[model samples]
Target: MRKSVLLFVTFVLFGLLSSAQQTKISEFDLYGCWVLENKKRPSTNIVTYKLCENVAHEDVKFGSKISLLAFNESEHESTGPLACFTTFTEKGTWEFDENSRIASLYSGHEWLKEFKQLDPDEYASWGSPEKFDKLKFRVISIENNQLTVEIIPKQYGKKRTEDSLE
Candidate 1:
């Protein structure tokens, strides 16, 4: 029991340290819930990607001196004739670099494949084997209540709004 408690405390401290290293997002105005618009259908030459219904719901909160950002993605609907493909749902903190306009997202302190619950043959197309622990984004623009970010690795565009609509 003592070991577990110490490990948990260490893990939490690591998260805080990393978050402190990056530029604080409080300088900007991303402090609200922004729902992703449009269905994302990503594909590669070898594997086909399926639409994960009810995709992403992101939230950005602020403290007196610190900021918090969290994103959760889920709702993997099985498509007909495709009994395979890994489910990619990640949730964690986000770090931003205002100078480079880059936002790096960090998943849980540690990644466990077993936590994903997948078949031996099934492979995740999106945020799978890679653990998506540090997904980066190049901020194209964020002004006047508009957010346009291009995800790295493939540069997929994602636009969000404050009105809850596309």
Candidate 2:
């Protein structure tokens, strides 16, 4: 009876350890449309990120949406025509690093030129490539159909290098 009890305890301990291990996130796990949750104004101006096989340009009622395609291409669309001076459809590329859990997005448009042409005052205020071209985010977790990411701050006086998703 003691031997059987010892065996049962060992089995239980092994099971517990196995359950404690975190599962690694794969590209397949990120293959879906995820909407950004706005805690302050949940119903207003919703931003969405769609990481899928194809890019779909859907109209948003309030905010903006970005579609990350399978071939590293991206499309961005925003509402509030007067407020947003940028083009209705902006093309870009995205990269994800599984090891570091870092995702980077590189916009294909010359935002500085566009902003200067559209709104000179706004362009003079904020028209840097650092502000408009590249964005990096560290993925915290994806749970219960929600993706949580933390913005990675840009490093000053250093050139940013891109990492390939593997």
The candidate scoring highest on TM-score is 2
Please write out the lDDT profile of model 2 over residues 95-151, one tens digit for every residue: 787887777777745665677778877766653453344667767677655556666
Cα TM-score of candidate 2? 0.51
All candidates: TM-score = 0.35, 0.51
Quantify all predictions' global Cα lDDT against the true fold.
Answer: 0.44, 0.59
- The list of candidate 1 runs beyond 4 A from truth reads 1-27, 39-90, 110-134, 154-166
Which 10 consecutive positions of candidate 1 have the poorest summed lDDT? 58-67
For every candidate, C-alpha RMSD to the true structure in Å:
19.4, 8.4
**lDDT of model 2 at position 73:** 69
Candidate 2: misplaced stretches above 4 Å? 1-21, 41-64, 78-87, 109-133, 160-166
Please estimate how well model 1 matches the true structure, expressed as its whole-model Cα lDDT: 0.44
Q: What lDDT score goes with residue 94 in model 1?
A: 66
lDDT tens per residue, model 1, 1-166: 9999999999999999998665433324444434334444245222111111323323211110112343422111122345343233344456666777665655443344554555434545433554443555566655444455566653335534456322
